[model samples]
Target: MHALSELRQARRFVIKVGSALLVQQGKPRVEWLASLAAEIADLRKASEVIVVSSGAIALGAAKLGLAKGGRGSLADAQAAASVGQVELARLWSDALGHHGITAAQMLVTIGDLEERRRYLNASATLARLLEAGAVPVVNENDSVATEEIRFGDNDRLAARVAQAAGAEAVLLLSDVDGLYDRDPREAGATLIERVEGVTPEVMAMASGASASGLGSGGMLAKLQAARIAERAGIALAIVNGTYVSPIARALDGPVGTLFVPQGDASARKAWLGGRLAPAGVLTVDAGCAVALEKGASLLAAGITEIEGDFARGDLVAIHGPKGERLGQGLVEYTAAECRSIRGLKQDRQADRLGYAPRAAVVHRDHMVRT
Candidate 1:
């Protein structure tokens, strides 16, 4: 099969366009946006597609005529984002309209994706857009987002979108072509083609931000995005956005850095790991902890203590004896019930709680082993 076919066969995908790709000469690149819309139009015929876009701040800055080399404070940045987001959506709508595709703009904050209910709601909205044959163009809600809670970069936002949308792959398009052994401009630096896994050595090769005065994210951010995709069992590709058909070319495997998925974790597990909020903690013994790490379920006997009050089905963090977080899982019983049955066997749960819900406090299927 053709390399591009791999991506073509994907049921869903999230494509991220960097600030550099969206802006040129301190303004939105109309032609680039049109080209990307055209590409998405083609891909939509074969698969569902969602776009995680950047450049709101850059566009806003240009529109507001912010002085160059001025003090770039958070207030300035936020002001710019407010101005630019309108233009960003307007450009997207006009560009995609050329191909008879409607574009729907969706602005999100980190809090939305980190919370389970909000995450599910966001996912549902995007899925509905896909079902309606419309492209959902997502961006960070920069106008009100504080630095502490900001996604920091669209690369990470794209990964979260991929996870939330149950996408099979995430394509991160940026100024650079792909990862290299070192800075490509430096003497003897070579491009690293395919990475089966992201090792410390590979991460060490990453450099800081680019010389181009476009965006904050660099090679390291893309690497971090890959790690997020990896944990979600979603493939990731980093390619140059300068090319006219960059997305098409990367899907065809012309040349790019591909980050392989770690394992086949279900969408629920991915959601649990990538999107859920932990309401409490479950401390376990060493043997039980190892079992949980090895992908085993959490039983009543293994649970030493229930640290917080939470309802049944609420997300909880599983901790080891030393208080290290082993992983997060949906608890089978209420915190009160769990506490009452601590150190009891599976059969004893019924007697303690008046009735047993399941054989384990957290079934393996409901748990995401870290």
Candidate 2:
């Protein structure tokens, strides 16, 4: 399959720009960004695009006259990120602005993506931004991120962002065009055009950490990212960003190594099924169980019991009348609110809950069948 073409055909995709591509000599590459922005403008005509960029710390280090290669104390790097994030956002705004596109900046920590409630919120924000025809430029919350709470590199972060946004593909723009059998510097080294899976052999072929001081990750990190994308049923590609119109070229030619997806659960379902532990349980009546078997959402009228304390957006176990676990889903109401509206018909729910009730206590789309 033509991997890059798949990205072009995707309804939505993410593009990751490494610090090495965005920053040179501690300065943002304005012309390169403009070129990329132009390509993104064309892609946006057919697909929604999100950008995960790295450069804030690098730019900040330069501005603060810190040592090169991001060599500094954690406090210094954080200080640099604080100063550089504004500049990074401005650069993206100006680049995309030239094409009449609006850029929205989003900063996220590991916890933001790991926590169920925060994950839902982040997903909603990304969906809203895309629906509004705005390109969301995401980055690690470097300013506030300690080493323990950080992604350590943008590659994995981009993959997570793609999964969160329900993107079909991710394009990792790096200094190298693609994965090589051996270091490209060595003779006879060949670029692997297509990767079916990130197996142990593939990981072994990868070399040490990033030689480019501006970036933190290397081929290993990218492979880790591809694995994440693979499980989320999202294709990922690693391509050279040094070339002009990289996305356009990748779409039309063999310009990168594409990692195939494993066709597993959707991102939301994956999280609902495995990533999170259920915060509570909702016991539904016999009729409700039958409705669920027919693919109906869990409504308050069907819910007979609520156990444990769970807030809105928390994952909850669904039990049938026989107390058998049916599935788990994200609950739309807090435990207290759910208790107030439990067993109420749609028309009477608002009276007990003191607000217009949602159609489902747990939406079918948000549920994962065991």
Candidate 3:
């Protein structure tokens, strides 16, 4: 009955459960998980739900007999994940089966979400599962992820998955209830009921982990997740796991920290923001360069040279004469077309390439300043 009515209207949502929620008193709480699964099943009646869960490493650590403060190193954590992932999925499957729902396990690494093709493929797979009436359970492929790009926290990973899947909202369930004006543990801290924007003041209230728990993320990580969701034009909410129907309640406007999207961005923009790397570089003439710098569309006549082999629609770096990267954008033509039209006059581009998609090599709307 919590007032998150807006959230309930969303047809698709991503729910992230932190490790601390899964492990209580240093042990896996199967009962709590069963309750969570039941709530998810209830939600599934009205919407497609994708669960992004963390706890494989924590469960693995317990199984491997690693005592508190005994997790050796990154290698040890990876090893634990390998051992616990199977068990984690099995437990979820068993719990979900009680509700007559099947859960599909999807383990992915940073590379999978960062690359455009892989990102689309991953999104397609999740969509297929939802269409087939199966819940897609996602987790980072901790066994192979390095520290640099590893979504050390599933909160951010869940946001990324939600964005990729075109989900309308993301629900992050953790130990804490929601964001606060200051540390809740402090004497006078107060809960922040709604967050319209992730401002500097809000960021200043973020704090690191306090409890000796299995989770890697804290409030700061949750805020970062909200930022990602906002940028992708998805609503976000942070709630306490103790609420058995937190997901449903959040959608109903219950007491939680809600983050409304700033505005809706095009799918292409989302893809660009999610791009891992640019395939090549496009250098334009001074006039074209100036136009681009001033937020003008990239014209075919502005091309002086194209570096690297890239196809149409591939993300490329736009550079000026002095090798300064003006921005990154989706290329309109293939490397061959670029070469054919290199140094051609604006009116002569069509004659050189036989046709033109647009006057510019990269459109301003398709570009993002680096």
Candidate 4:
């Protein structure tokens, strides 16, 4: 349908670019990229921007004359990424530099986002880069990324990055204008403008990978990304990047499928704590319950017993000594670790466990008081 008002009002957001739009016929489209950079420069004055770009492997392989066209072995792909990353970064730097804008390259792997400590650190880095007035151009570390750990496409990565970066919206710019009932060129295919929710029916409309060799994601990946972004209370727009100044146009017009969130950030946090069933239950003493009421974390010393087997990062219900449920939160330590440290002095946790963990069993940020 039309551009969401939230898209235009976003003070911070992500713009994802795929390889097909960045390159054509094994050659970099410098002029198109320069124009896009100009738009980014203009957007930066009033709002913060983070770019998730994909093109290193394609441009890199083409430069080295490696497979004539498609991907080679994992080793060959990583080799291409190692070489192309340099050129890709340089080109982005030069283009943005022309507009007096600074572009910083931050290559990340799946581990960086999946691990709790690394996730916080990576998010802080991106926040700092935006605060310093430099646009962070994020790319997956393809060189060493195995299939098991790989994001597979930049679309899902962009969605995850949007959540971590605290971005209000995510703009996915690809060759397609928006999502359709089917392939647009085919008869009876109709453009679906706004996706209020990503349902089984909505997912059924999605297709496979892109026909273009330069790009990896198709509509399916973008829809999958929209689901992730929606859960994090971020809106995602799937827009066409085939034109110059795509970002601004997408924000100003009916350019793609806009998936709006059903709730705000606080609501999303509430959902995280209670929406999913608790993996396990945790029993804490009275003092810990009081501390939780005062907005403190669940420390090991405060917990008297662990009720079930739950891995780290799993949601757990917190209970008072009398078996009264206090609330739920994400646990930082596994059940086995908690078993060893339960009732132990908080300060002596490292000595007992042989390694230090987070000071709190569950941080306030991940805990919700009910």
**If scored against the real structure, what TM-score would every candidate get?**
0.77, 0.73, 0.76, 0.74
Between prediction 3 and prediction 4, which has the larger TM-score? 3
Pairwise TM-score winner, candidates 1 and 3:
1
lDDT of 2 at 50: 97
**What does candidate 1's lDDT look like per residue over 142-204, in tens digits?**
898877777878888899999888899888998877999988899998877678767668888
Selected candidate, larger TM-score, 2 vs 3? 3
lDDT tens string, model 2, 125-188?
9999999999999999888888766788889889888888999899999899899999989999
lDDT of 3 at 246: 60
RMSD in order of candidates: 4.8, 9.3, 6.0, 8.4
lDDT of 3 by residue, 82-160 (tens): 8879888998899899999999999998777877789889989998999999989999988777677677888888988
Taking the candidates one at a time, how many backbone clashes does each contain? Answer: 0, 0, 17, 1
Candidate 2 global TM-score: 0.73
Cα misplacement distance, residue 53 of candidate 3 (Å): 0.4
Superior by lDDT: candidate 1 or candidate 2:
2
RMSD after Cα superposition, model 2: 9.3
Over 4 Å off, model 4: 68-70, 265-370
